[model samples]
Target chain A: MKTYLPPKSTLIVWQIRVTVLLALLVAVLYWFIADYFLVLFCVSLVLAVVFNLIYFPAFLRCYSISVNQNAIIIKSGVFIKHERILPFPRMIYAEKQQTLVAKAFSVSALVLRVARAATLTVELKDNDIAEIMKAVAKWQ
Target chain B: MAVKLKITAHPIMIFYYLKPFWFVLIIPLIKAIVSAVIKAEVNNVLLNELFISVVLITYSVIKWKKLKINISSDFIEIYLGVVRRRYANIPINKISTIETTKSPLDYIFGTQKVKINTEAGKQGSADFWFKLNVGDVKKVTELYPEKVTPKTIKFSAVRVAVMAATSSSAFTGIVLVVPIINQAVRLLGTAVTDLLLDRINKIGQLFSKFMPPVVNTVTVVFLISYFIAFLISFFKSVNFKVVFAGKKTGVFSGLLVLRKVLFNTKSVNSVCIEQTPLMRFFARYLLRVGIGGYGNRKGDRAVVVPSAKRDEVHELFSVLFPKFEPADNKIKPHKNTRWRFYYLPTLFLAVSVILYLVLSYSFPVFKGLISFGFIVTACVLAYYYSLAEYNTKHSCISVAPVIYANYTRWSATREMFCEHNRIGIIHITRWPVDKRKNTCNVRLTVRSEAAESITVKHISYNELTDEIKSLYQI
Candidate 1:
């Protein structure tokens, strides 16, 4: 089974963005309360950084998507792992979508519309997206 | 056949436009007459009513004139709208269902409303009319002769009545009547309201004279609403039957307004056999089918069997889904995982206990009653959790070309069967605790915008994955 991982830099950028957002939230709370929330904010900031440092690497490592002749397997999550197998026949459509951040990072997301109600999104390099689409076409 | 055969709908459809505004017209007309009699100034009120009536009539006339239904060999095109000139071209093959409804007014006018429901979701059915004198329902049925012919199964009047009486639809009817009841109370005045309440209190006194006023009032309201609900349900499903012809299922029902509905069986997303608490005691089940395009956006699904015995349900299932089996090989969650079901309820009880302790300090008089209520709630929660655990244990998934899932919702258990090919997505979620326990929640979603999903919690993750891979050859 072949495996593909998202760009490592993209994960780092995402984590940095999340950390910044949390810092802004904490700053807003500090502005409002001006109490022992300063201590709580510091603790939260450290915990968030530590948790992200530990989880993001594991997530990057574990987050592998593989497309076979019949099914697309999405293996994700760090502590609690998820291995979703979406069969080709069951997939309604597959499209490559790029957000502003993803476009800046030169990465794209392959969104698979599965069965009636479920969708699976896997991040891939811009170049790899075309390859995945070709693979999907071949399977079809 | 001509290239394009254009025809105007029966003139009765003009009334369809006016039907919605009838109340608007009637309310003001009544007010105008009352004001005229009370205040001797009739000209302004009468003029206002006449002006509104004229505008409504003109609008309906314009709408009626513009509405044109063109029947081609391949498609049915509807052209209407005065300002926008809207055009709708529905392919004949894509037409999933055709329903005809006949109100008392329609019967008197020798006409009926024909609603053409295409495989379009949410947009709603396209309604026209059939002039009983000009064209019979046979003309529409003749267009799809092969699909329309089916073996009909008519429910007995007694059976229909029983089914309706036991249905939860009565509860919804009771909810609808609440506003009407309120309006009536307001219109009739407090004297009538007090009399009714007194009568209800007297009836409640018969049950338990020592009961609190609040409890007595609640009991009386419940009894009255339940009776009204029974009447509504009985009337709604008075004449119910299902006609199975090839791949199409025709449902004919209604009492005052007759409804003849037809839909393709292939479009059925899932079959749900639901039984309310009352029906559970009688061993009766209501079988409803969710259609794909329509989704489960309320009343979209057709009730093939409104109410039936266990054996009758089995027969209905066999007839509807001949290729699929309704029975399942049961799967049980690990005993250790039963904590998952009990965790939330136990936490709730703990929170309630803390609240009781805190609040009892302020209100000492109600402390004993509150404690008793809390204990009763805790006991009920414990019993409910036990039932939920049992439901999880019995819930099973089977694959035989089609997937059949047997699970419980609240106290009522249901068996849902859907084609494997129709399954859109299968989601398996595991929490950190579940990771350690090796148990996960599995959800099978069918293609419906309404998100019709079947979730089976606390199942062995490895077992389910292995089973799916082997069974589906994925």
Candidate 2:
């Protein structure tokens, strides 16, 4: 985990901020048109609770992982739980990413795929992803 | 003998072509309603509809004129479209199947429309084309003027009788009246209930009160309604006339548009027949042939020879391929690769049944039917498939550039014979469970598609690798 720990990128923080902003925008829309503030208040509480439930433990379990071979196992979800075991063998492509919040946290993720590599956004230190990409592309 | 065909739109038939105009008129009515509701000026909206209708009518007329189609001893040629000026010439011998339809336009006007599908080349695409009346349809047939066709033999009388009975005048009229029949049934039910039981709002109330009895009655009515549609489909599918002459093979059939399609034999890509569960139950089935033509749309390209009794598929097959006949008796599992394809589907069913039972509380009725059918059919099919696979050891499959399978009711099973030489990319898939099992799900790519398509399923990895090595690879 220490050897592979990511140098958090500016992009990760940007993305997190963008997502949060979009969520708050939706929250604010409800605040204006809603006949009752009670429903809005209730919805916001539920959102915060759900978000915390999804991210806190999941981020902890996943953010500390490194693998020499095989796949990264991301454990997530509260009620409808899932484990995404992504194999390096299926890695057709890869990229490095960063965000401000992730930089603050000193963490990142990596996305890898065989077909649609664009969809597998692996958030990690730019150097780690560069090393991973060089190794994976050798198969092709 | 084929008589030459020169098709020209009858001046009177132009009125029949105006069906699209109905839509053209609808634009204005909608515009007027919107304009009135919003209190906007109506003139611009009215002018737009007028301008649009003129453009549509002009385009239709141009399409009618440029569509130069002719069937001769040599070939069938169709020149189509206004700006593109695309022309397709399919030699008579390349014809796989020809289908003609009679839209309500032709039905009312006593005219018929033709959609001819030939095999191999892209040229055999059917256009919403030039009109032919009943006599004109027959005249179009005469255009294929050639003499002493490939050995005239009287087609079986039983076949003729079946065709005639299916498409007899009364049968056709009733078949043609299906939508009306449905309307009539609804009307009759309302009329009878109104006169006998209900003086006021009563049908729904009665049904809600006498729930089971009402449910049974409605079920019976719906079943009959479905049967009526089936009967109509059967009738419409009959009365086919297949002609094999010098270079041309043509089919003259259809209730509405008596059609003739001619193409060469070499162009035929593939042919298959399917039996629905209902068809299997009643021993009556529909025969669909996919030819190499623009039959890309839903029903236009496939010829539906409906209501053939079981194994009576042999009757139509004679017209289609006439060369190969599968032995009548049940095949030994070892004889073909069909058995190898059965296991994955069976396992899939078992897994799905388990999933549904787990989820059934959300939808009890859906869950019941799913688990019921899955548990029952999956067990039986799995057993048969096991026997078939065990009995028939690794058998080589024929390669087609394109392959098709007979449609079955209980499951989705397609057979393909894609030419290994032409396949651009290949995928060998195995799920987590399948990896231990050592079975490969083979998928092959086509040029036009974005990704590879599943060509076949459930062959042992060893057998699959060997087959790919020996046949597909050098």
i-RMSD values for every candidate model: 11.7, 20.8
Docking class of 2: incorrect
List the global CA lDDT of all models: 0.68, 0.49
Residues B1-474, model 2: lDDT tens digits: 253776666544445455766755855567676877698565776777767777767777776776566666755655555643443444444344455566666667776656554322234244235566678777766655668555332334344444443433333333333434444445444444444454555765564446545445665666566566545554444455556576545554545434445554433333445433223334454444433443543422334354466466657566555543432221121223345456566677667667766766665534434445455556656654643353244222333323322222233222222233335567778877557666655655532112224344555667656645755554
lDDT of 1 by residue, B327-435 (tens): 3544457777866766776788788788878866775645555555566567657766755665646666765457777776666677788877767799989999889
Q: Which stretches of model 2 miss by more than 4 angstroms?
A: A1-140, B1-7, B23-98, B102-111, B116-128, B133-221, B255-263, B279-288, B294-427, B432-438, B443-456, B469-474
What count of clashes does model 2 give? 50
CA deviation > 4 Å runs, candidate 1: A1-140, B1-7, B19-55, B72-74, B123-136, B147-149, B169-219, B294-299, B326-364, B367-386, B467-474
Clashing pairs in 1: A114-B424, A115-B424, A116-B424, A116-B447
- Which RMSD values do the candidates have, in order? 15.1, 17.9
